[model samples]
Target: MNRLALLLAGSAVLAVATITPASASTASAGEVDTVTSCGNSGLQSGLSTRLCAEVTGTTVEFYGTVGLAGPPSPGGPGPAPKELITTLSTEVVGSGAAPTQQIAHVLFTSANLQVRGSAATVPCGSTVRATFGVASFPWAPRPVAHEVVITC
Candidate 1:
């Protein structure tokens, strides 16, 4: 009887091990995952920014510029002049499944910028990356603020 019990236990253990995938057992409940994307102006004529993030465990605090476009014609087909501005700021926070896309809009003097992207669900820490450039509107033509990337 003892020998039979030992054989059955060993076979059951082996069967369970074979049925499980390696990733499941290797990843602990405390482990975290991340998602990322790049900011770009696919929808040109104005500013388009991509907000990307890497969500760690749970509860993440992240900050980033949604979108930026540039050098608008002094007077041409573009955003209304009154919308042009020297600076812009935006914010967002929430939780859900993983890899949910988020969208935001930024208005500048000569152009309108749209930000579209995703963020990680909460309980997980979030890391953000952003890019900014000189306003597309005409000004003193200060140094062209090429692509600026900041990590938050």
Candidate 2:
């Protein structure tokens, strides 16, 4: 894995683990900020897509899932992919998300599509608005993008 991916992956473990209820202390560094969106019409192909992001401290950890809407079971076999996409691309972009305002693209080959990455540091209480984009897939007219807004 590249350095950036490795760093973000490692940070995910800590960010997800350190989440705690907001405390009264002003020295807050790990208060949790989270958001999830799923089962919406914005998706295609009868797809059940879920986007979640947990921001703890100055780190942002995100994960997403894509599968048929009514799978027999969680992560169960969904309809066969109508087309073979060797690589699927995804990213998280938002205001105050990056210093350069550039999005980070992460590649995936698995259907799980669950990914996590850290973004640029911003002060607490700064409105963090992000759009999680999943590359177009089989039977989908275009890529799917889900917007999430939360405070960190």
- Give the Å shift of residue 75 in candidate 1: 29
Clashing pairs in 2: none
Q: Write the per-residue lDDT of candidate 1 for residues 1-106, one digit (tens) a residue.
A: 9999999999999999999999986888765565333334332224443333334443232333323355656767665543323221222323233333333334
How far off is residue 31 in model 2, in Å? 9.5
Please report the candidate that would top TM-score against the real structure.
Answer: 2
lDDT of residue 9 for candidate 2: 93
Q: Which stretches of candidate 1 lie over 4 Å from their true place?
A: 1-21, 35-47, 59-134, 139-152
Clashes within 3 Å, all models in order:
17, 0
Q: Write the per-residue lDDT of candidate 2 for residues 70-133, one digit (tens) a residue.
A: 5356676644543322222223344423322223344333354454445545555554443434
Q: lDDT of all predictions, in order shown?
A: 0.38, 0.46
lDDT of 1 at 63: 30
